[model samples]
Target: MLVPLTRQKFEQLIPRIATGDQYRYVWGKFSDFLRRLLASVVAVVVVLLLRWLLGEGFGGLLLPFGVVGGFYWLWGPVLWASLRNAQYRKYKYSGFFRGRILDVYISEELIGREETVNNKGELVYVDNLERRLNVEVGDETGFSIQVQVPLRRSHKGIARRQVAEMIVLSNRADLSNITKVTDIYIPSRDIWVSDYPFLQRDVFVEVSNRIRRDRLESEEESPRTPRRPPQRKEPPQLPRQDREW
Candidate 1:
């Protein structure tokens, strides 16, 4: 069964996450790619117009300026639109609670034994490996689940770490982080937590439970259920009829 990760477990797994400027670099590249593609299309259009109207010489010089200005002019709106769209998508299809699962991946099982020291200088139990689960939620603004199992205990520190990393990355880099994701696949029960992360506990629980129930009911109503065949009585006079014939 899947189990949810605790906050403490999440913090322990923080070592694996990439932070600081690394996230910025990755997001920047993505943004730049989109901007460049849009700009290129605009530039091509401008050049085609310039060549047809002004022809050679000064047109070539003016073409560059036209393209450059067009580039800047288009940037703000495009950027706004991109961000807005990203935000919209994040929310529109948010897989919060019982929403759609964008993707799922299974990682290697963690096993073994280890010991660690906490702030109290006391020995803490640690495991070598546990099960890892990744679940993504939300539309444009989305959240994700990452849980790790300890070789010793079922502590899902790795999973929590992944979730926390996603949260931080989204907030820092202005990714679509519309909501907090808590109720995810719990390694403990191998089922989803009956709550959404960001919402009120009661509300999240209610919503999640309702969604789960509805899905179950729908499945029960599916036409794939086998129908019982009609029963037939045995033919009692077969032997006598055969003798008469």
Candidate 2:
């Protein structure tokens, strides 16, 4: 099914970004909250030092600005989400495909990050090779694609031959995206698996059904090639035997 993309439709289809497995960010609200508080404290400390060295007026002039700058941590995710949404909008064409899980690949790549203390004792972050689970899905059209999803506890639930459907977006018709994704929905499990939650579940279901219905109607209306009837066999041999008797 070809799903036309508009700004409103795009907005409706994709959900807001959240931290954790869906997005490669430090998990939990506390992490961001703590960082924001820490930033505010550091900003205050800098201001106090400025007050001691310079003057109260100089410190006071920048206090509010410094304090507000610290809260940049709060806008981090919001800005990130908005930027990503704009990038995703470039993929104007989207389609819904139904396929079965052909195979799953377990691999590692630098898609994760973690904080650690270096020799200097200052907190630092380094690249980590995270477990990436790629599911190979194909449909009757002989087209197949690999969808990379986060390796989580639910990974175990995704098994081979499971009927899975996904909403894939592209600038053109060809499939693209290795590091990013729109959304993948597994009906059997009633779960969504993707890098970003780009699909509204209820709307997806409604759209999927409409697409299927249209396909069925089109197939029904199409003219089918007439079939040749099977030739009938004669009972002459049995009739001859009965006449001779």
CA RMSD of each candidate after superposition: 20.8, 13.9
- Residue-level lDDT tens digits of model 2 in 77-139: 555665666676566555555678899778888966889999999999998788878998766
User: Which numbered prediction scores highest in TM-score against the true structure?
Assistant: 2
Q: What is each predicted model's overall lDDT from 0 to 1?
A: 0.40, 0.63
- How does model 1 fare in lDDT? 0.40
The CA-based lDDT of model 2 is what?
0.63
Segments of candidate 1 deviating more than 4 angstroms: 1-93, 97-197, 225-245
Model 1 TM-score, 2 decimals: 0.23
Pairs that clash in candidate 2:
none
lDDT tens digits, residue span 188-238, model 1: 233433211222334334434554465578679988958688689564321
Ten-residue region with minimum lDDT total, candidate 2: 236-245
Error of 2 at 117 (Å): 13
